[model samples]
Target: MEAIYIDKHYNLVVECKQGSRKACYELYRLYSKAMLNVAFRIVGNIGEAEDVLQEAFLDAFNKLKDFRQETTFGLWLKQIVVNRSINLLRKRRLELIELEGDHLENIPEEESEDEDDVQYQVAVVKEGIKELPDGYRVVLSLYLLEGYDHEEISQILNISENTSRTQFLRAKRKLMEILKRKGPAS
Candidate 1:
């Protein structure tokens, strides 16, 4: 007996290319949750993030023909979602404020205020992240959470690499401050 073919990605792409709505929905169900997390981290709003996710899906479904498989489908889809999320930030006039020439040049990478006192809880961290200003939050989320390097982040956000690094550093410090105020993790 011949082995049954089971190329999920190939089959999904073929189905989607042939304009199967079910396949499209299947793709959406497969990727939307992770994509939503990525969008939410950047946009910092559930409604806006959902909007970005939907728009990304629309583009992905419609542009399925352009997906040449240079990368995996998930990666291609994520790129679209991230770009859309950044666009939403742009629509909001997300400003990349320059650092005010503070003495952050020598601040140790991992040192926080009273290092021994720092205890992070997931809830506390998410709240702290949400509290960050748009610039810092976007930089932090894109670089740390989304796995983009400084150069990629600079390009995505249209800021200098230095600015991206500075923003991440500032964001980390501010997050620590927020966590400290919230007290130790329970």
Candidate 2:
């Protein structure tokens, strides 16, 4: 059973790479829901997220040659989805406020003091993160949620690495502010 599942995935990728429409459909069926979740997380709007998914899949199919085997095909496709979602955000011309380097370094690292209630602390932090501005939200999602580094974020957003760092720091501050506004953290 395990081998058959693996073979199906591998064959779908190889056949899709070879321009087989049936393989592409199979791959899409397998990955689309997960890809849509990623897209919706980054884009935050269902309609826009769907658009990103479509564009991402098209780009992935077209550039199959460029995909090296450093990562699994699903991971590669997820990266494309993330990159395309970031591109869509940039196209909306959101103004990213550039923070100073010193400010970036000084972001407060407030680890939860109460160790007994870890789940509550995590829930508070998650809510705070969701309340951040769109730019900060997207940057935080790409950096922390999607596991992309500053250089990769720079390339994805066409901004400098410094800018990526600054945005991440600022996003953290914004999250803190949101948490603060939500009353005392228990």
Q: Give the TM-score of candidate 2.
A: 0.76
Highest lDDT model number: 1
Candidate 1: Cα lDDT at 164: 89
Residue 99 lDDT in model 1?
59
Cα-based lDDT for every prediction: 0.85, 0.81
lDDT of 1 by residue, 1-186 (tens): 533344457678779999988988888998899999999999999999999999999999889998776677888889999999999989898889665555464345444465344554556689999999998999999988989999999898888888888998898888888878987645
lDDT of 2 by residue, 60-79 (tens): 89998776566678888998
Clashing pairs in 2: none
Minimal lDDT window, size 10, model 2 = 1-10
Q: Per-prediction TM-score, please?
A: 0.85, 0.76
Supply every candidate's count of residue pairs whose N, Cα or C atoms clash at under 3 angstroms: 0, 0
